[model samples]
Structure formats: structure tokens, C-alpha cells
Target: MGVSLRDVADLAGVSVKTVSNVVNGYAHVAPATRAKVEEALSRLDYRPNLSARNLRRGRTGVIALALPELDAPYFAELSRFVIDAAAEQRWLVVIEQTDGSLERERQILDGVRDHRVDGLILSPIAIGADELAARTDETALVLLGERIHDGPADHVAIDNVRAARDVTEHLIGLGRTRVAALGAQDSAVSGTAPLRLAGYREALAAHGLPETVVRVERYRRADGAAAMAGLLTGGDRPDAVFCFNDLLALGALRAILSRGLRVPEDIALAGLDDIEDGRYSTPTLTTVAPDKAELARIAVDLLRRRIDGRSGHAPQEVRAGYRLMARESTLGR
Candidate 1:
């Protein structure tokens, strides 16, 4: 009844395929063809039928972004970036949480065949390289964070080990020997936690310091608070603490303040992933800044390319470097 894609294509003097490409936001379409199609659509009042488009393209025009927790400011900001990137290409984002569980990761992977989304950008928890290699055949999977294995799929991440080493070195340079490592873990698959922890240990080794006082946890703000509280009361009190993330660092900040201790003056604190809230926090968080927007841009582009059958470009392992932003939290005013 209403204006159709056919009408727009016919009016534009282009093949239906060309019109489809234009509507789908394909990057390869010429500007002239796109302009003509757009003009014809506007003239005919032709609206896109998303359902029909999905059927034609055999794609849902949706991508899944599986993250750990949206409550964390970093994940929240990361989700926003991914959503914006996908939206520019006329794609939708479906967010999921793994709760840092292996079973949940498996379930998310199994869901790819259901047509909920054409691809996935995963911040997998406890997922191994073998599992990803087996599951990524049907859907385009872009792995994010240190949890992902260096296997198949395009990866977007920062060099966590180097970043952590730099953070530790910075603390060391400040003459803080009794440095406490917060959020340490024995192992993590598909994320930067393990790598960063390894770097922390490496930094300690480099400085000829003991790596005995690591506070392992699930990397939550509460966990940071609890870990810091334990360290404060325990016999081995750290002169400085390096948390795995800003949320944890914030928690530690609260714990340190409650003890009537001055930040940096009593115990210096630092963290990674310089989230938005970190900048505004009292004694603003000192953290490793990753270019989240750029990471999102690359991830969206990579998934789009994979879905479009552009496999000539090999799997890209883009590691965005981190910058140590010294703030009030680490440097006593």
C-alpha cells in the first residue's frame, strides 16, 4: 500500500541490490548512488521496513554486547560507546551480562544461532580460547578485554600487563615500597585481570619487592572495601594500593577515609579504566585511561566487516595503549 523499496530503486535508476545496500548503510556504496536513492526515498515517502530488510539480508541488524556488570561505570560507558557506534551503521545493540560465570558465557554463545543478533561483542568471563574457537562459526564474535583468548575472532583491548606495570612503576618511583595489589586473581580467561595482575607481580619483581600481600577478590567496589579493610587491620599495612578498576578504587577510597587516613599521605591509591565518575570523585581517581570511544569504533567496524563477508582482512588484534593519569587520589594535594 505505502511506498516500497522497489519504487525508490526504480525512481533512482539503480538495481534493487544497490538500493538495499544504501538502505543498509553499507560502506562500499558510492555517494552518488546513495544520494539518488535517498532523494527517491524522500520523494516517494518510502520508509524502511526493518523486518523486510532483516529477511532480505538474512541478518537481524542487531548485535549483542555481553558485559560483566552495567553498574560499573566503565561497563556502563563502554555499553554507551558500543550502542552509539552500532547506531551509526543502522544496527541495534542487545546487552547481556555474564555475572562472571562460565556457564553464563556458554549460554550466551549458544544464543547466537537464534537470530537475536547478527554478531556479538563479548567481554567474556571465564571463557577459554577453545570454547570461542568452537562457537564463532555461525556468528561474528568480537572479543573484548583480557578474558578473551588469543584465538579466533577480532579482538579490541588495551595492553593490560604493560599498563599495570607502568602503574606499579609509577608507585614505585614515588618511593612506595609496601604496595598492596587489590583485586588480584589466580586466573581469568578472556579479560585483562590476569594479565594486569601478572604485570603487578612483574613490577614488584623488577623492584626487588615482595609480592606477598595481593588481595584477591571478584573486583567489586565492596570487594575493594573489604580487601582494604583487611589490609589496614592486618599486620602488613601497604603504603600504596593499586586496584584493578575505578569502582574498586572508589571503594578503597571510602575505606581509607573512614579510617581517618589521608589519601596519598597515608596510603596512595591507583586504579585502571579511568571512568567518567572517577574524574569527579573526591580526590579524583588516578587510573589508566583507555580510549573507549576508539575501541568501540573499531569493534563496530570489525563486526560489520565480518558480517559483510569481507574476510580478506585478517583478524585484527588492536591493543589500545593506556595512559596513567595522576590525580588527587594518588598525589596528595
Candidate 2:
């Protein structure tokens, strides 16, 4: 027969109830008892029956992490951090890619509530307050971005507006005018798109500069490159451009270079997210770097707390930190 909890308890020299308590994450168990029980479990290679345990405890011991696109470097890196953070709490993560589709996101919410996961960490870009408000799930759902801020869920985010404004201001401080904005596909909506654009405009208005933008259907390298190329070939062009994310900014860089335009001399560039690819680009990108690791940690922590019924009655809002990373992309030195 396969090893079981009883065998682990016997090997650990502890009562079955005591072993169970340790397994259930009961803090009252002494450190020595926990260590002994854990050692026995390791030796016996005992894997708890997750389904039975979940039925008894009403917890699946797993959380669903839903993002728009798994291929985006920013979301990919965020998933890595969330997985690490969740593991520290003895929770497994099941990632679901929504492909920025509202229908898929809604389906994931329903699926999570159907007992597939104990909680959900959602990074919804296409979903809005109306969509979120329509749900009646009691499952612990924590949003990972500012797009759905008004929904009835705990949220973790960076100050998108302030971060965007600071990066735009940084470009302005470098004496670059005729600045154009990129990555605002739906500026009328109450999401990251509008919030980041609001920041960009504030910086421009403060400097007494007019706003010009190259809207795109998506925030990807190909779209960003296309937007910049069109701007360059047109009668109107920007001396500096603020892309909403690193991917878009990197795309614009390629477009800038392909046309034989020297960076920061002919066109300065800035972007958000400060992704790893941005750090190593030919002329290192100047970006508004949000504390992505902290964002993941906080979102996971909040979701865990909600699942444990430890969070306050009201939903929580936590804004992670951000900073402007100025480098070769916008400077001569």
C-alpha cells in the first residue's frame, strides 16, 4: 500500500490529530512537532489527497492567476514572481491566459468559482467595472492592476498616472518638445490606457505643449513599430515619444533606428514597465519602472488573506512603488 497520513504520523512519533494539525497549517503546533511531522512526510513521500482535503477544509490549496497575454514580457515576468510568492505560502498557482479577451476572462471567473481554485488574482485589461460588478462570486478575487479599480475586489497597482506623468516630464526636462504618446487604444475607458494617457497630458499641459498621439489597437512591438514608422514618414513627427509599456517602446526604437534616426538626438524615447529587454536595448531605454515584484507579492498576499477570512470587511487597495529610469535612450551620456 502507498504511504499515508497514518504512516507519516506513526513515523513522526506523533498522534494522528497532531500530524493533521501540522499538515493543515495550524500555528499552535510547536516548531519541533512541525519539523518532525514535515520530516516524516518527506521521508514517506506522502502526498495529501488534495480533493479530500479541500472538501474537508473548503479550500483547494491552489489559486488561479489570470492575465491578458502570457507572451508579453511584463506579464510573463509578473507570473514568475507570483508563482514564487504563492509557493512561499504553500499554495500552487494555476495560470490562465485570457488573451486580452473579455469573454475568456469572464469564463475564467466562473470556472474559478466552480471550485477549481481557492482564489483568483486577475490582471484584467479589457474588463471594466460593469463586467466585474455583474459577478456575484464569494470567492476571493484580487485584481493585479488599476484597470478595474472600482470593482468590489482587493487590488494591487502602481500609480499609473503619476508614473506616466513622471516619465513624460523626464523627457521634457531633457528639452524634448513635440512629444507624442503611444499605447492609448481606448482612452475613453476607465482603465490603464486612460489613466496613463491622463498623466501624459498633464505633463504636456504643464509645459504648455500640445498633445499628439498615434493610437494602436494593441500594445505590442509590431504595433508600436508601425505607429512610430508612420509618424516618421508623415509631415508631423515627435522629438520624444512616451510608450505605455516596454514592449511598445522597444518596437518604436527599432522603427527609429531603421529609418537612420539617431536616438536622443533626432528622437528621444521613454516607456513603462522597465522590462529586462528594455535594460539591454542598444540605447538602454528610459522607462517608468514599477516595482513588479512587490506588485505580485502584495496581490498574492492579499488574496491569501481574503481566502483565510483574515482581511477586513472592506476591499483593500494597495499601490506598489514606481520610479523613472533615465538612460541612453533619452540622454547623451
Candidate 3:
């Protein structure tokens, strides 16, 4: 038979109520008493019956993490951090990929009514403010990206405009006058591309430079390569390129090198999201590195607050920090 709370309480010379308090993370227990109870728990290898405890508390002891694309390095890395954060809270995480589909995202939102999980952390790509506002599932939700701003949920994201501006400014400071931006999108449901484009434009206007943009259907390496190829052949070659993400930047690097062009010599390049691939690329990559671990931690913490009824009536919009990592792609190795 498994060791019970009674066994721990008996070994600690305390009542079962005191043992239960410590197990449940109650603050009323004295420090010394808590330590003693913890020692007793360890000695007996007493594992709490999570199922029974959750049943009593009316919770599932689980949370859902919904992201647009699990295959994206940024999202994959962020998911790792979120899993670690949720583990600290003793909560299991179920990850769902929406593939950036509006209908698929809405279906996940509607699934909240099923109560399969206690809360949700979502990095939306398609759903908008109206869709979020119309949600009637009453599930504790925390937004992870710039998809739906100021909606009826806690939001955690980096300052996309500022991050983009900083990367663009890095190229300008390198004396690249003809800087072009890749990854502008026509979608009105997603805010990431637009916010980044705004930042790029802001930097250009501040520097008295012309604004050159390449619209992309998606943020992928192929899109970046194709756009770079077009820029090269279209007779308006930019001396520098700022891709919205590292994958695009890497793709552009390949296209430039395939044509025997030197990076940061003939044309400097920069991007956002410092994924691992950026660091190990041929000339490396100059990119903006958002505090992804911190973003995940904050998102998980906010969701836990909502799940525990500790959040206030008004939703919170928290901005994570980021830094521009100057590497060989722009500065030369």
C-alpha cells in the first residue's frame, strides 16, 4: 500500500490537518513545522494523491498551451520553457497546434467548455478581438502573443514595434542606407507582422531613409529566399535586409550566398527571434532575442493566477523584454 498523509503526520509528530496544510501549500503553517513535515514526507516517500486532491478542489490539475505553429523554432523553444514553468506549479500541460487556421483556433477556444483542462495559454495567429470578446466558455485564458490585444484575458508579449525598430536601427547604424523589410502580411487578424512593419517604418523615417517592404504570405525560409531573389533581380537591391524572423533571414542568407554575394559586405542582414539556427549559420545572424523563457514563465504564472481566482477583474497586459544580438550577418564575423 502507498504511504498516506496519516503516515507522514505520525512520523512528524503532528496532526493529519497540519500535514495536509503543508501538502496543499498553505501559508498558515509555521516554517519549522513545515520543514519537519517536509522531512517526514521525504522520509516516507509520501506522494500526495493528486487525483483525489484535484477532485476535491474541482480542478483537473492540467492546463492547455495553444500555439499557432509548433514546428516554428520560436514556438518550439517557447513550449519547452512553458512546460518547465508549468511543472514548477505541479500542473501538466497539453499542447495543441492550430496551424494558424482561424477555424481551428476557434474550435480550440470552444473546447474550453469541455473542461478537459483548467486553463489555457494561447499564442493566437488568426482569432481577433471580436472573436476573443465573444468567447463564452469562461475558461481561464492568457494570451501569449500580439494576436488579440486588450482582450478579455491576460496578455504576455514583447514590444514587437520596439524590437523591430531596434534591429532596423542596428543595420542603419552599420551605414546600410537601402534597408528593406521582409514579412509584411495582408492579414488583419494577426498583429505581429503589422507591428513589426510599423517599427521598421519608424526606424526608416527617423533615419530619413526610404521605406521598402516585401509582402509575404507566410514567415518561412522559402518566402524569405523568394523575396530576396526578387529584390536582387527587380533592379532595386537593398544594401540591407531585416527579416521578421530568423528562418526568413537564414533563407535570405542562402539566396545571397547562392548568388556569390557577401553578407555585411555587399548586403547586411538582420532578423527577429534569435532561434538556435541563427547562431550556427554560416556568417551567423544578427537578430532580436526576446526573453522567451521569461515570456513563458510570465504567461504560465498569469494563467495560474486566473485558474486560482487570484487575478483581478481587469485583465493585464505584460510586455516581456528583448535585446538585439549583433552577429556576423550584419557586423561581419
Candidate 4:
């Protein structure tokens, strides 16, 4: 008969479940709502049930890192950095792959996660901010990449538009005209593709150069190979290609070689996410090098702070540093 959760919920003008989310440090709850709940809890002197407090104290001490696809070299490389970073704090990591499916992402967000992990570092691909905002379940989440939603979660990402624009400018600096943007995601409104495409368009406008575009269902090596093949057979082929990622750039490199063309001599090539394979290819790739190690370090540190029970702090939005690596692939051997 003491102050129950229902009383706190009523006082905060939210549901009991929402009050629970606020107390449990869920990510999706609005700042105002969480603040109101905290104020109500203070006024009512609310304390969690003994059993709940004991359960929270018995944390598994592990955390989950979920990405769209681990098969992608960039993600695989990032996993390496994250694992190493987590080891610094003596915490284990659980990796989850969503296979680039919105349904799967929604399922993960549904709170069916392994209770052992204290929190999550998620890189959502198929879901956007609007869809995430509509969800009621809350998790301690730190989002990575260009977030589609503006939720109360920490975000770690690089400036995609600026990176892409710089790549395009590099191509322009190489005296290459008729540059085509390869690996565009078709039938999609969000993701790396849209932002990079925006940069490509921006660079074209700034330099007064016409843009060449090819749309694909997804960003993959196979997608890049196929798109490059089609462009080889079509009219007004490009002299340079700025792919959305390293996988696509490598795929296109193979296609160009098989078609009896030498890279840089025939078409300059560039990509993002300085994956290792791209560095040692026959003609090394030029790319926007996002500091993956720094990204992992910063994100893991943020998660650690939350794990240490730091509360009443606004979520942070951090941008990782990146530099354009002008390699032999684009600069000529």
C-alpha cells in the first residue's frame, strides 16, 4: 500500500511500463518524459523492489554489438576494433547480425535480447528514426552511423556527405571528367547510399560537372560488379567511379579488369571505409578512412559510462574523425 509504480506513473502522466523503462535506463524514452518520471520518483521517494535491485546488480557484464551485416569487410574490421576495445575494460562482447532486414532489427529492438549484456551498440540499416520513435520498448542503445531517428540515444558517426564530396573532389582533382557514382541503393530513402549520393551531387554542382549515376538493390560486391558491367556496355561510360564502400569498389575493380581495362589508366576508382583488402589489391584503393578504432573506443567508453550507473545526463552525439587516403588506385601507380 506504499507508493506503488502506478502512483509514480500517474504522477508522471505516463504509463507504468514507461516508468519502468525510465528506471531501467531504456534508450527510446523521451528526455522530457524521463525527467518527469525522475521528478515524480524524487517527490514520492520511490525505491525499486529489493528483488529488482538485486537482479540489476547481478549483471552478466557482457554487452552486445549489433550490425547489419558482418560479412562486409568494413563491419568485420570494425568488430575487431570493438573486441579489442572491450577487452581494455575486461568486458566481453556478443555480436549480432541483422542481415539488413527491418523485421529482424525490429525483433532485436523488441527487448528479446540476452539479459547478460549490460547494453547495446547498434548500427541500424533497414530501420529509420521514425520507425524507432514509434516503438515503446526501450533498451540502452548507442546508435552508429547516420541515424534515421532522433531518439535519446548516443550516436557515433562520421560526416558521410562531406566524405563523399571529398572523394568526388579528388576525382575532379585527378583531371577526370564523366565520373560516375557507383553502388547507389535503389528503392531506398535512407542509409549510406543516400547521404553519399547527396555528396556526389553536391560536388558535381560545385564543380559544374555532369553526374553519372547507377542504382542497385543493395551495396555489395556482386552489386558493384553487375553495375559496372552494365555501365561498360552502355553509352557515355565514366572515366572514374566513386563507390559507396570498399566492397563495391573491389567488385567494380574486378569487373573493369576482366573487361580488359587497367585501373587508373582507364578509370580511376575510390571507395569509403578503408578496409584492409582494398589496401593490398593489385591497384590499392583510395578511400575515405573513417577512424574505426577511434569510433569503437568512443562508443565503448560511452556504454561503459552508462554501465557504471551514470544517470541524469543528456545523450551525446559524437562524430568520428576521417581523412581521405589518396592511394594508387585513384592517383595512378
Candidate 5:
């Protein structure tokens, strides 16, 4: 038979109720008592009976994480952090991909009839404020990313405009005047691109530099390659490039190398999101690194509070922190 709460309590010299309270994450438990209970749990390899616990609590102890693209390294890494944060609270995470489709996002917002999970953490790419405001589902929701600002949910994200400006300023500090931005998009679905572009423009304007933007349908390697190729063949070439994400920057690096032009010597480059690939690229990559672990922790904690009826009626908007990581891409190796 599996070890039960009674076994843990017996080993810890505490009442079963105390063990139960500690397991349930009650804040009132004394630190020493909690530590004792935790040690006992570990010693006995005690696993809580989630089915029985959920039956009593009227919750599934599960949360859904909806992301636009799991294939993207940034999103993939963020998902890992979210899963870790959820696991700390003894919660299970169900990952859902929206494919950056408005219809799919709307479906997720509208359809929560089953109450299969206690709450949801969504990184919306296509959904807007109107659709979010129209959501009728009572399921606790937390949002990630810049899409759907001032919506009816707890939100967590890094400051996109500020981060973008910081990256652009870093390139400018290196004495690159003609810096081109590679990830501008004409689509109304995503809010991230526009905010980033605004930051780049703001930085350039402050330095009295002319703006050069290349629009792409998507922020992919192919798009970056195509955009860089066009920029290279143009009448006036930029002295530097600021890609919206590391993938695009890496792609641009490929295009630069294909043209037999040296990085930093001929043109400096930078990007955001600081994905793993950036660290190992030929010229490396200078990028903005968001505190993804902290972001995930904050999002999960907010959702947990909402699920436990602890969060107040007023929605929360939390901004996570980020820093610029300079590497070989912009600075000489």
C-alpha cells in the first residue's frame, strides 16, 4: 500500500491534520513543523492522493497553458519554467497550441464549459481586447505577452518597448548609425511586433538617425534571410541591424556571412529573446534576456490565488524584468 498522510504525520510526530494542512500549502503552518512534515514526506516517499483531495476541494488541480507557438525556442523555454512553477504547487499543466490564430484563441476563450482545469495561462497572439472582454467563461485566467492590454485577467510580461529600446541603444552605443530593424509586421493580430518597432524607432529618433524598417509576414529564419538579402541589395545599406528576436538575428547573420561580409566590422547585429541558439551561433548573439522563470512563477502564483479565491476582484498587471546580454554579434569576438 502507498504511504498515506497518517504515515507522514506519524513519522513527523505531528497530527494528521497538521500534515494535511502542510500538504495543502496553508500559510499558517509553523516553519519548523512544515519542514518536519516535508522531511517525513520525503523519507517515506509519500504521495498525496490527488483524486481524493480534488474530490474534497471540488477542483481538478490542473491548469492549462495556452501558447501561440511551442516550436519557438523562447516559448518552449517559457513553457518549461511554467511547468516547473506549477509542479511546485502540486499542480499539473496541460499545454495547448493556438497557432497564432484568432479563431483558435476565441475558441479557447469561449469554450470552458467542462471546467476540466481550474485555471488557464494564455500567451495570446491574435486575440484582442474586445474578444477578451467578451469572454463569458468564469474560469480563472492569466495572460502572457502584450496582446489584449487592459483586459479582464491577471497579466505578466516584460516591458517590450523598453527592452527593445535598450537593445537598439546598445547597438547605437557601438557607433552604428544606420541601424535597420528586421521584424516589423503589418498584421493587426500581434501587439509585440509593433511595440518593439516603436522602441527601435524611439531610440533612433533620439539619436537623430533615419529609420529603416523591413516588414515580414512572420518572425522566422527565412523571413530574416529574405529581408537581409533585400537590405543588402538596396541602394543604402545599414551599418547595423536589430532583429526583434534571436532567430531573426541568426538568420540575418547567415545572410551576412553568405555575402562574405564580416560581422561587427562591417555591420553590427543584435536581437531579443536570448534563445539558446544565440549563445552558440558563429558570431554569437547580443540580445535581450527576459526573466522567464520569474515571469512563469508570477503567472502561476496569480492563477493559483484566483483559483483559491484569494485574489481580489481587481485584475493585476505585473511587469517582469529583462536585461541586455552583449556577445560577439555586436561586439568583436
Candidate 6:
């Protein structure tokens, strides 16, 4: 017969309830008891039956992690971080991609009432206030990225406005004007897009420049290349471009190279979210770096607390400050 909780408890010389408490991380068990239980579990190779445990405790020990797209490097990295953090706490993560759709995000939220997961960690794209408010009551949901309604759920996110502004300022400091901001999805009602644009404008305004030179495009490399092409073909071309993301920046780089324009000499490019590829690309990207791993740690921590019915430990609006990484793309130094 396979080893069970009872076998583990017997080997550990502790009551089965004590072993259970240790397994569940109930926080009431003594250190010595926990050590004994852990040792016993290791010796017996005991793995708790998660389904049976869920049935007994009314908790799935699982969280729903929803993002816009897994294809994006930012979202993929974020998911990896979140999954790792959840694993540390003995919880499992179920990932879902909503594709930045309002209806799909609503559907995921509605699934909470059906007990699909013990809690939810959502990065919503086009959620309405009513929908956000409706979902907050029944489930433990922690909002990420854009600020949703501030009713019941906890929020862990970067200050997108400030981060974006700082990145813009870095480009400005490189002595480049006629700056262009790129990557604003069509039908994007979320504040993240505009907030980033606002930052770009603010940077321009600080330098006594106008903000009329912006090209809104979908959040894709192709969109970025097309937008850049249009700007170059037009009469007024920006000497510098601050893209919303690394992917867009990559596309911009492609467009610049295709047009036989020398980066940092003819035009400089910068972006946010310093992905791995950014570091390795020819004329390495200049961008704003977010503490991605830390963000994931905080998100997982918040979700776990909500599931445990604990409150008031919320880390209030962590900035996760951005670092302006100056690379050859902007100005070789």
C-alpha cells in the first residue's frame, strides 16, 4: 500500500491531527512538531491528496491567475514569477488568458462564485467598474496592473504613470526632441494606455515641447513597425521614440534599421519593461526595468492572505520603482 498521512504521523511519533496541521501550514503547530512531520513525510514520500483535502476543507488550494496574453514576454515572465511564488506557499496556480477582452474577463470573475478557485489574481484589460465591484464581494481577488474598483479586493501593482514618465525623461535627458509615443491599443478603455501617454506628454511639456506627435497603435511589433514607418514617411519625424513596451521598441528598432537610419545618431529609441531580449539585441535597448520577481512575490502573497481570511497586511500600493537603463539604442556611452 502507498504511504498515507496516518503512516507519516506514526513514523513522526505525533498525532495525525498534528501531522495534518503541519501539512496545512496552520501556524499553530510548534517548530519541533513541524520538523518531525516534515521528516516523516520525506521518509514515507507522502503526498497529500489535494482533491480529498479540498473536499474536506472547502478550499481547492488553487488560485486562478488571469492575464491578457501569455505570448507577451512581460506577461510570460509575470506568470512564471507568480507560479514560483505560489509554489513556495504550497499552493497551485491555474493560468487563464483573457486576450484583453471585457466579456472574457467578466466570465473569469463570474467563475469565482462557481468555486473554480479559492481566489483569483487578475490583470484585467477592459473591465468596467460595475463588473469589478460585482466580483469583489464573493471571492478573494487581487487586482494587478490597472486599478479596478476599490471595494474589497487587494491591489499589488506598479505606478505605471510614474514609471512611464521616468522612462520618457530618460529619453529627453539624452537631448532628443520631437519625441513620439507609441502603442495604444484601439478600443483600449483601460487607464494604463492613457496614463503612459500622459507621462510621455508630461515629459515633453517639461521640456517646453508639444505633445501632438503621437501615434497610437495596437500592442504588437507589427503595429509598432507600421506606426514608425508612418512617422518616418510623414513630414514631421520624431528624433526619438518612447515605446510602451520592449516588443514595440524592438519593432521600432527594425523600422529604423530598415530605413538605414543610425540608432542614437539619427534617432534614439527607448521603452519600458526591460525584457531579456532587450539586453541582447544589437544596439541593446534603453528601457525602464520593473522588479518583476518582486511584483510576483507580492501578488502571490496578497492572494494567499485573502484565502486565509486575513486582512490589514496589505502592502499599500507598492511602486516597484523603475530604473532607466541607458543602452546603445538611445545613446552609446
Q: Estimated TM-score per prediction?
A: 0.86, 0.90, 0.86, 0.80, 0.84, 0.85
Top model number, lDDT? 3
**Against the true structure, candidate 2 has what lDDT?**
0.88
List residue ranges in candidate 4 displaced over 4 A: 1-58, 112-114, 310-313
* Candidate 5 residue-wise lDDT, 144-239, digit = tens: 867456678888889999999999999999988899999988875656898999899999999999999998877778888888999999999998
User: Model 4: which residue pairs collide?
Assistant: 129-148, 129-149
lDDT of 3 by residue, 128-243 (tens): 88879888888999999784566878999999999999999989998889999998988847669989999999999998999899988777899899988988997878999999
User: For model 2, how does the per-residue alpha-carbon lDDT over 1-333 read when each residue is reduced to its tens digit?
Assistant: 577788999999999888888877988998988999999989989888778778988888899999988889999988999999999998999989998887898899878878879999998867777867778878989999775665678999999989989988988898888999998885335568888898999999999999987788888999999989988988877999999888999999999999999898899999999889999999999998888889999999898889887588788889999888998999942
lDDT of 3: 0.90
| Candidate 2 lDDT trough over 10 residues, lowest sum | 185-194
lDDT of each: 0.83, 0.88, 0.90, 0.85, 0.89, 0.80
How many clashes in candidate 1?
8
Candidates ranked, most accurate by TM-score first? 2, 3, 1, 6, 5, 4
Clashes of each: 8, 0, 0, 2, 0, 0
lDDT: the better of candidates 1 and 6: 1
With candidate 1 superimposed using the best TM-score fit, by how many Å does residue 242's alpha carbon deviate from the native? 0.5
Best by TM-score: 2
User: Which residue pairs in candidate 6 have backbone atoms (N, alpha carbon, C) closer than 3 angstroms, thus clashing?
Assistant: none
Q: After superposition, how far is residue 153 of candidate 6 from its true place, in Å?
A: 2.9
- The alpha-carbon lDDT assigned to residue 111 of candidate 4 equals 54
Clash pairs, model 3 backbone: none
lDDT of 6 by residue, 1-333 (tens): 577788998999988888888887899888888998999999888988877778888988889899989999889988999999999987889998998888888888887767768888888788865656655456777877765435346777777778778888887787776778887655666647777887887888889976644455456688778788888898877888889889888888899899999787888898888888899988899988888888888887877777787666543454455577889888832
